[model samples]
Target: MSRFPTTPDLDRLFRPRSVAIAGASTNVDSPGHDYVQAIKNMGFAGPIYPLNRSADEVAGLKAYAALTDAPGEVDLVISCLPAGAVLDLVDQCGKKGVRFLHLFTGRFSETGDDEAADLERQIAASAAAKGVRILGPNGMGLYHPGGGLSFRPDLPVAAGTVAFLSQSGNNAVEVITRGNARGMKFGKVANYGNGLDVTPGEMLRYLADDTETTVIGAYVEGVPDGRGFYEGLAAAAAKKPVIIHKAGRTQAGARSAASHTAALAGTAELWSTVLKQAGAHEARNQEQLLDLMLGADMLPSSGGRNIAIVGGGGGRSVQSADAAEENGFTVVPLPDDVRRRVREKAPGLADWVGNPVDQSILAGSGLSSNGLLELMLESAAYDLAIANVGEDWFFGRPDASDRLKHACNRLAQICETSAKPVAVVLGATETNNREHRAIVDEVRDDFAARGIPVYPSVERAAFALGRLAGG
Candidate 1:
């Protein structure tokens, strides 16, 4: 009943059988060269027709002078041509029966020029009349590794199930690069810059039913159709976890967004209310967005707010407790059974340590922070947990690397085996010591490789867990 195509039909747009890059060029620095090289690098298993008016070959592929000159049918057409030339390109795509036309071309509407805005309107009208869906008039288009499609050649080639829809191309690139570094694998990603013919709402509706996508994250400056965006967001959020970062909250930011993407940005209060009512988690910035996405995809669903905190020294333990409680998680006290086990292991310090088992006090005892974590998770007192690696303490100790690795290995195993969700916290590698940095990086990478949710700080870990647990 919706205007947007369901998953089956949307697949054709994403996984196009054949692609054509209009304005394909020989210069490697330009986007024209990047599209051709990107799809080729992604190993797109389809005919790639590079449409160029003059060049005989672009990116080592035979180039056509026009869309009509291509031998095979073109399913997706990526336009890098000038703004003035887009109308003709759209007509060519319509005549060729092209289902999608991604305009990497800009300078229309967002330029704040009356003539440019008029041109954008005409372009929209023409595309609709010709039955051609335009992804963006000022956007970097799709990036679906599974479909062998990428806008930039430098993007990661590994396919994943975390789908993201961003209004800013640079933001999308940052999310992909940073999220991938933090073990967030992405599936379908689109930068619907101005949301001209194909709005973010329609994309949301499509991703809602997409079997390949398990979690969804979106970065939006504004929407042309507010009602449609709301409906689409509510529908998607009803099915799976959705994280939305709405930028352009301030007046200046709203103006910038308008000039940046021709978007009518909304106020912070209005967007916050809408996101909450729509059943989607609201992220304030890129960091929060990535953290929420990581939590949603990697951690299991937890219904209770009771949390068990472990690791770190006295100061970090206090900090962790404050963070957990501030994020709406109850730093539940260790139950009698856990205390009984602690007494059995180390009777002298059983009462000294509380919910957050201070690693400093348990130094000589046979019990490790990981051991306490295992015992606490086994009890019915807690529903989730946060484990701090306290790498700084290990750095000062004898044989730091070996001890750190051994502890981290045990902690990772505990996280992997635990029925309740445990978010690991390893401080950001900020020390000047080169060896220490490597050890920290190595351990964090290991955790990521094992598909464990690891955060740089306890506060971030608590915030992510709290949000995911509906706190």
Candidate 2:
């Protein structure tokens, strides 16, 4: 019934027994240095060799003059050398029987240099002859925390259910960092730039059946093989929900994508149709991409498009309704039974409260927002629920700490057994006030630890939920 019953095994390429860093340097500021730092810091066992002719030691690893001189079999090679030097290095990699070569070096076809294009072709030819897998000629390589792998030292080392493949290295870093703030953990990520050999489609096919991956997110600026990617997307969607951000929609944007990754960005309208057909959610930007990544895995598959909004004032409620409806969700009013339950339980606010249950009305009314949240969960009238933190109002009060803690803890507890996808809306990341930021961060951490998905705003939460709701 499904296209891909099994996916490719990329273990040796990722979980190498021995890894060599080509062009590895002791320069703390360089990408070469970051690679070595990440490897050693992650406690990656086995032989770790740094191949650099000029350096005596690179990030504390014993420096080898070259790959040929390195002791033992080199399973993986991460090249951080200049693009001009990669062709010669590719031949050396083949000679040394290296199974994989990950290139952090750029200046290839993306540069639009004729000489650079020829060098990229040579890399492909050399790798093919030796049966060596090339990750990228201009890429950030791999980021798998469980395997003690990463291109940058700052990324999260704790792995989780989400796995992502990004064509742009910077976008990869942004997605990982931003997703981390929202309590997102990742299983694997790859910044496969200028994809000379290891195409985005292949990574998709691999992740489609990856046991560690339950949810998948992808950011692509371009791809050479449209049919291959579509097939991969369809197959992956059959096994798990796949969310994608297809960049380079505009003519100017396509030119930019080409220059950045040497990608052939297809038409936007066509991409929209293709993604919908493939059962993939098309993320307009990287932020929404993170939302899909978290919601797709954390929320259940049966989440309906009908959303019941609670919390926020008149303006926020209107905004939430608009956001939900705009994203293809129905923001329904409080059903008759739920209203009845609220009336009996807390009769004072029955007349004032409605959909988007304005928290301001319930003050000193003996009714709690948590109680309303629970009532929504119990009622069959609502398919999904949104709980707004109303952080700005809470923090403005002198008794901010007690009020914030009580509300967050209560909502966190209620969401523990929620059958429906109950989303909590909190304020955005605070930068100016350290004290306020810490308080919000603590609340977010609590919700994350308890396995509840939290969003910065109702709009974002609604958009994320809408995508998961099959919009």
Candidate 3:
């Protein structure tokens, strides 16, 4: 009964039978030429028509003078021409029966010029009347992981559960780059620069029903239609999680947003209320936004707020407590029975068995490989357990390294057994200690592979866990 398209429109953009580049050129540095090459580089398996009046060929592909002159039917038309020339191209696309139009030209309403705004409205009107779907007038076009359409020339497309939409082109690039570094792949990414025709609401509606996407993340400076945006988000959140980062929090940020996307920043309280009602998580900043999105995309949806912090250092425990409190998570202390078990298993050193349980007491204990892990698993008070092992030297206890690995594996097994979630926090110096760093990296990698989120900072780990708990 959903009114939105259940399937993604990527077939028209990424896997089109035929594509016509209205402003295609031979100059590699030009935007049109660069885009054409980027599509080819991403392994697009479709016929490409270079529509250049002067050039005989573009990047060795034969050039056609017009979309009509192309050898076959065109599913997509990519326009990288001057802003003034784009309207005519849109008209041409309608005549050619093109279903997808990607406009890379910039001088739309985003420039804040009256003339440019009028032109954008005109183009949208024309496209709507002709039943053509337009992407952007000042946007990053599109990225479809399955069909390998990446607007970014530097990075290859990576398929993931998170679908991202940004209002700023540069912010989209930053998110993609940073997300890639953090092992967060994207199913589809689009920048609705001015959002002349295709708005965030439309994108959300499209992605909400996408089977390939499990989470939706967005960066918004403003919304053209607040009610529509809320409706779309509410509908989407009913099915999957939606995390958003609003940029214009301050007066200066508001002005910057206006200039960047011609967005009219609304009252913060209104935005917050709307987002809360829609069940969308509001992120404070870019890093937190990505953190929340990654957690939502990667973690299970059933965990509660009870968190057990297992780390070597007392400072880590304190930091984790502070972060948990800030994020509205309860840091449950180890029960008396659990503390007694840890002491019994680790009698070689002094034990401080409390909430944010310091596992360092077993640092030099000649305990079995499963000593600390056994203590944690026996304690049923904690819904989620976070283990923070400092360095490799601490793993020197009898089978301690194996114990730590076994503990992590067992924690995941416990989660599977109890239907709860467990995450690990690996805190170690990133530089000036290659050997120790390598050991920490290996442990972190192992934990991540088992569906346990790992973080370098205790705060980050706690934050991710809190978000997972819907805090």
Candidate 4:
């Protein structure tokens, strides 16, 4: 029924029974040694063959002179040899019945030399002829956890539904580590540098029906196969939420991308239009990309723009209102019915309450700040709500720390029942204020555990919500 492989394959590339690190070595700083150690660090429960002609061992693993000399069958080979030498390695792999060869070797077409480009082409042709798929003439290869493989040691150990395919090796690590801190767990992530083999479009096709992947995030420097990308992205986005961060958006950025990965950074305008046509959200920066995924993953879509602000004093309320309106949200006044309900709860204080319900004004009143929020949560006047987890203010009061946690629990419970999007704004990632920072950190974790997305600032919260709503 589906065109893509229902079962993961190029199977050995992911779940290799035996992986031969072709150029694996004992050098502390070398990538050759890093691959072996990285995999071992990830706790891969498989036989590892270190293929080195000269070295007796690599990273303290048993060394074989070649793939053919290994004690047993080899499912995958990671080639860290010179570019010119990859052709010979491919031939050996074909003879050994190796299913996949990861060409970690670079200095091919990326150097912009005609001879190097020709050599890359020859290797690709040879691999294809022998029924072997090449990962890269220049790439970081795969990082699939379920199958027990990883290229870098720092990647998250816990597997998740987020799948990321990045063209920049270092950027892939950055996104993965930073996103992991924000509770963005991952499923399958690959850094397909120079994309000589296993292009972005092909990865998309396979990921489209990948049940393990609920969300797909990608960082592409270029798209040489525009038509293929269009088709694959459209198909995948049809099944799951797709967020793309197209890096090369300017003249300077284009030049950097081209030199960095030998990519042809297409015009920003055309890329933007293409993303819209394919129904993919285009993120301008890494933070924005992270914001959008959180919106897609955590918030429910009501498709309505009305918002009721619930926390922050008059100053914070005004600032939040500006941000919400700037991001296409209608900060409507509290409706009469909701006000009447509030009046019943706190007869004396309801007269002073409005949309924002300044916490200071309601302090001495019989009504709690959360009671006003409960009224706003149900009001039809607002399609969604923003509750500021005022953690900074809660400090120094009697039993205030525990109250903050309880307040967050209440907001999380309200969100669970509300069909509408309810974004919470917590403050300060600035590290100088460790006390405030520590409090915010624990509260953010509390919110995260309760399945609430917290933003550092009101503007960021509003901006992310706006993009998720497509306004």
Candidate 5:
């Protein structure tokens, strides 16, 4: 038999045949008990064994006193016990022949003390010796739509292409909550806190082969084995886009990370070199990270770095230009031919029809003309095109009801012919009219269906373009 089974190992951990909650509780408020109820509520098909020495039944399921008492082969064991008790539980799991373990306890190696570090090492050795894989010691654990394993009560976990892994539990929850609000869904999320046995390298290697995951994102504090991390990232990045937000670079950030995950904070330059060599895109902040991942997840691959910026306002165009330059992309000026075409097509437009290709004149005329947009796209001067359509274009003109649809269709045709990526930025105030917001939503959906990403801000759109161009 293969040491690592040819069959996918995650099925047992994520969609187990039988699950045993080692620290099962009757209180609905407890994390341990709430998760058990979440599994049942989300319609897990497998039998659930809630293990508690004091209880006979838990959350309507038959309770067992220990792993050994649970009937048949228990594929997954979710231990919500204290850190001190985790070792004994592992011993029990080994004897019981449990294959996968999900630990939710903190204050282990992440504490950065000798005792905690030794305890973590021992647990790793024990699990490896028993041929059992561990998820986390200080992790929030795993989430699978099919298995309904979510510690977060607010967000409804759903299966999608994106799979995320993070070292910070709060960051994991924040990403899930925020992404859900923005219409971004996930297939799986693992908060690999402290990373006792399983490192980001191992997780990336595993996720690379997972058919359920298409786009991978990570919030990494530090990598223990730089070579292994780089190798694993290279392999995974070759298969799919890997967006990483590496924290703990600064001295203060490093100190913060020790408290967060007991991670050894390294120099920022070293981290940047490793990430660049590994073909991974490093994000500067949380918002940029999300935008980069969403863009990579949603947009098709492209070959060129040339970009065209279109906007109804000159100010938005300038903002796009600044962002593009800041993110390592060259903002090319429109060629003479392209400029002449734009001027002829929209005579009402401004005379400064260069790289930005402003359509303010046409938009201001209340004509709803996408002529300038089409002219720039057809010029083939750019590998990607970004259009910033203000709320005025959508709600200002009485005859501009179909302006968004017309622009979207034109952009789609341009993308098809050029085989280049296209994105849009629809800027509207949070307190904008419902009708104007509806137009922005419609445009976003339409562009998404065509495999183009839409952003609410020009900076975000430019950042996404930069990532793709960098890759």
Candidate 6:
């Protein structure tokens, strides 16, 4: 038999028709309360049985004393009980024929207590014997909006095709919240803390075959099984774009991860090699991970490294050139045909402007940056393009809001009609000017609503585009 050959049925787990929350409470502050409230808030289309020993009701639903008491077939049981109470919970789950048991309870092996570690081992053994798949002993569990599931009540309700797996619950929340702002609508998400029974490997294998998941992103502290993880990762990456952000690189970081999830961290170099060999992209940090996933999910595939950048000022052009070249992209010079087209509209810029298309020099020219972007993408000289919004420049002009909105609308139209991918660069809302910040935010929201990928900097846009282009 293969070691880790069998993967869990994640479809049933992710899309459970009936769910029960053990240790459900009425206290509005606790995780127990959060789970119950979150499910109710998500408009779960199934029966929600809250298993509470004392409370008669939890978050407006009648509470059962135990999982066995829940009057119907329960597909998934979320345990918010203490670690000491988990062994009994597992037995109850088995007796009830529960398909999945997600333990939001912590203080297990990650606490570095011998008794706790032993208890965790026993829980895993019992769960396996009962044929009930475990999601976490100290994790936040699932957040699939499409299936009416969420770990938190405040999360966005939009359903998408992007799937993400993380070891830390907070990290998972950050990625979902932040990625959503970047126009990344997430489909399935799991934060399997400690990764006791259903490891990242198993999740990857499941997601590899998942029809709903178009792109996969992972935030890993460590893996319980290395070879299995690699195989699963390789399988998934071969099918769709997979971006892995492996944390716990340094010794201190590893030690922290060990405490955080009882995970045994590996060397950064080794992890990098493994990720590359598995045909997956490696992200150094959370920011890079989000950027890569966003690019892979939002932009169409591009096999060429030739980049056409149009927007920003002369300084931005220089920085963009440096960023593009540094990231292994060729900032190709403007083709003669493109230059002649520019000369017809603006004779002065045809000679002065090079590849980056300095918007400053074309101030008086009837052509806008969006116009230049359309023209550049038309030529065979470029494979992909980047258009910089340069909101700071707009802030200095008359009627910044109207002008910015007009430019962005044109850019959005261009992106919609263009055959090649165009990544837009809009500065972060870092300005002290309130009006400027609001205008920038509105523009970003507009772009996001139109499904245009916007990066905070030209360098990030370049990096994401370059990596996606296989540079």
Q: How accurate is candidate 5 locally (lDDT)?
A: 0.75
Model 5, 224-316: lDDT tens per residue?
656667767887788889999999989999999888888887899988888898888998789878888877876666567777777657776
- Misplaced by over 4 Å in model 4 are 1-12, 54-60, 395-403, 416-419
lDDT of 1: 0.91
Between prediction 4 and prediction 5, which has the larger TM-score? 4
TM-score per candidate, chains pooled? 0.98, 0.94, 0.87, 0.91, 0.86, 0.98
Q: Show model 1 residue runs off by greater than 4 Å.
A: 1-8
Candidate achieving the largest lDDT:
1
Tally clashing residue pairs in candidate 2: 0
Clashes per candidate (backbone, < 3 Å):
0, 0, 1, 0, 1, 0
What is the Cα-based lDDT of residue 215 in candidate 6?
97
lDDT of 2 by residue, 1-471 (tens): 233346665787768999999988888998889999988876677789999898888887789999998989999999999877887888888899998999988888899999888888888887899888998878998888878888888777787878889999889999988887677888788888988877777778888878888989999998877777887888888899899999999999999999999998989999999999998889998778888888886777644677777777677878888887897887677888888888897888777787777777888888777788888778876788888988877878888988899988988888878888888898876659788888998999888877788998888998888778742
In order, the Cα lDDT scores of the candidates are: 0.91, 0.84, 0.73, 0.81, 0.75, 0.91
Candidate 1: which pairs clash? none
Give every collision pair in model 2: none
Q: What is the lDDT of residue 327 in candidate 2?
A: 76
Candidate 3 — which residues are off by over 4 angstroms? 1-15, 336-344, 347-352, 367-379, 392-419, 427-452
Question: Which residue pairs clash in candidate 5?
Answer: 306-383
The TM-score that candidate 5 achieves is 0.86
1-471 in candidate 4: lDDT tens per residue?
A: 333334235545667888999888888798888899888887888898988889898888889888889988888898889887888999998999888888878898778899988999999898889988887768888787777788876666777778888988888888888777666677788887888767788788778878888888899999656777777788888888899999989999999888777899999999999999988889999988888887777788857888888877788878888998999988888789888988888788767777766776777778766777778878777788888766656765677667877887787788777888888888875657666677678878777766677788888999888877743
Q: Give the better candidate number (1 or 4) by lDDT.
A: 1
- Between 2 and 4, whose lDDT is larger? 2
The predicted structure with the larger lDDT, 2 or 5, is: 2
Off by over 4 Å in 5: 1-11, 146-148, 330-354, 364-371, 392-419, 428-452
